[model samples]
Target: MAIYLVGDIQGCYDSLCVLLDMAAFNPQHDHLYVTGDLVARGPDSLATLRFMQELGEHGHTVLGNHDLHLLAVAKGIMRPKARDKIRAILDAPDREKLLQWLRHQPLLIHNETKNETASGFVITHAGIPPHWTVREAKQSARDVEAILHSDRYLWLLQNMYSDEPSMWSSSLEGIEYYRYTINAFTRMRFLTMSGNLDMACKLSPDKMSDENLVPWFAAKRRETIKETIIFGHWAALGGIFQNNFLGLDTGCVWGGSLTMVRWEDGQKFNLSCPV
Candidate 1:
């Protein structure tokens, strides 16, 4: 009974299958915790979504920025970009079922195993904001999640895109608050030393020329610093392991390897993207 935490699949269904095979994954006995971007930008969005949905209780995914974008596009709130290869998913026979499953997925997942030796891990598409404690991050996720599942979900999908309120504030209210929370959990990668999100910086940490900007995990006074956090979204960082943070987005869709890690033993498995 192993638990595998996987990086961004991003619609690379064949790569996912290869990695699962290499890990000898048994859906009946093993569990998969995917760090989002389950669809878009790869060769097989429809197959990827279908496979994840079929996993049922054995698998679950945190919502990435691309996942949210899919919802928005499906709902006619946003148009698909030229680079987005999600039309197959939108046109699939089970498109509604797949999208519904994705919409219901959580923005944050806290896994506290019963085993005394297992360390608890929080999985999110992107890293949590430095100002948020684990509890606060969970609460913020719930706030947006509730809306995503509610009748007014279309409203959220329509209004969720924005870069304002770049810093966390307890007083943030309404759609502004939800947008900020969503960005932090899905699109955030770098932050200024002052704790404001550097939305424009998407390069790997070493490549960035801005001395004032730092990765979210490197921010000082982060409340979730004591807990282990597993996230994807930043493919530029590849498989970064720093302190209590583990980054698993190895850019599989961009010709890198698909990576997965077993939580109990910390053993990693990778499958190179097909040429």
Candidate 2:
């Protein structure tokens, strides 16, 4: 049984199907680890959610920022934007089931195996913060996941839309703590030299003029630097493969290609999006 880690699908179901076909994916045999952003921005979100839900145990996805936004919109905490394209999912007959499935998804997936020279990997929608170690990140994610799956989730979703507390601190508590953890796992991209999140800069490294803002993975003395992190959300980076960081968002919804990485051998597969 193979495990394929795929980039953000957004709502591009056709590209997802084509990429799976190219990979010869067998739902019954192979496992799919999705980098999240499963529904939004593209067409066919309902179909995409249905397909992923049907995959059951064979498929897993980390919750992305867009995915969280969907939950907020569904709960009337936020209004749907004109470009969201997720109305189909909210209006679908199986909306409850789909949202339930999405809510149950974690913000972080850590699989540490003994095979292939102690191979282990962590998957998140955006990326883990430089301040938290791999184990710490996982624990923080669990803390928030509990709230998300609990009865108080509606309150959390309603209050999760702020960028305050832009830095990590162990002393943080309450909804602010959870919000920071969520941002780290779902919206993080770059960090200031002092290890504080630089939320405003979304441009790629080459395009950015600020030298103080470093990619989260490139921060000095990052505790999780040794851990292999697989993440999406930075489509501008376009499938960056570094020593320990694997970026899989290739902008399929923006006329790029859908990309996936076979976990066993680290072999990559791609299917170009239609023009």
Candidate 3:
């Protein structure tokens, strides 16, 4: 079966469908995996969420920062942003079921098989820290996933925002814990040249300095996973990157093209957003 790893959809539903058709995906046989951020920023978030929910059974996805925020705001756990365009999903007749599936999505997906290209794919929404062993990273993710999918998930989502450590830690608590985990899984872009999270840097390459910040995938310990890691959430960084990590976010909301990667050969493709 062909496995296609895609970038952040970001509510670009039509674009995603276009890419899927281009790939000629066979849902009954082939597989598709996404890097998350399935909703928000662009139009058609409701359609995007519903589509992903239908595929989540056969596809793999890690919860993106925006995806979590959608859940938070929907449940009144967090207030909706001024510019968010998620009302369709929130008011939908199937909103509860769709959001529940999204919230239950995992934070990481590792190809458990032993093959080279076909197996050993580690997919996440953002990127895991350089210090975390593969086992540790997966375990930490499991911890967060449990809460995100649990009966008390709304409680955690209600209080899930902070900027405490800005790095990985085995012992973190409260908002700090959820915050760091979320950042690592979503907002991570650059790391200090000396190997630390650089949370303040968000420029699109040109404005970044070589003194302290490096893209997380370029940092040390990226090879610890020993496989391909496909992810999105880094529109500024754009498509493809260091090691086996494939970045699929093409910033379709920012007037960029929507993108997807075919794992059978790691081929990338883009579809323009309809204006």
- CA lDDT scores, all candidates in order: 0.91, 0.90, 0.79
Clashes of each: 0, 0, 1
Where does candidate 3 stray beyond 4 Å?
114-119, 193-195
Q: TM-scores of all models? A: 0.97, 0.97, 0.92
Candidate 1 vs candidate 3: which has greater lDDT? 1
How far off is residue 158 in model 2, in Å?
0.6
TM-score winner between candidates 1 and 3: 1
Higher-lDDT candidate among 1 and 2?
A: 1
Q: Which stretches of candidate 2 lie over 4 Å from their true place?
A: 222-225
Residue 111, model 2: Cα distance from true site in angstroms: 1.0
TM-score for candidate 2, residues paired by index: 0.97
**C-alpha lDDT (0 to 100) for residue 41 of candidate 1:** 87
lDDT of 1: 0.91
Q: How big is the positional error of residue 16 in model 2, measured in Å on the Cα after superposition?
A: 0.7
lDDT: worst 10-residue window of model 2: 218-227
Per-residue alpha-carbon lDDT of candidate 1 for residues 179-246, written as tens digits (9 for 90 to 100): 99999999999999888987998899889998999998888765445668999999999888767899
Candidate with more favorable, higher TM-score: 2 or 3: 2
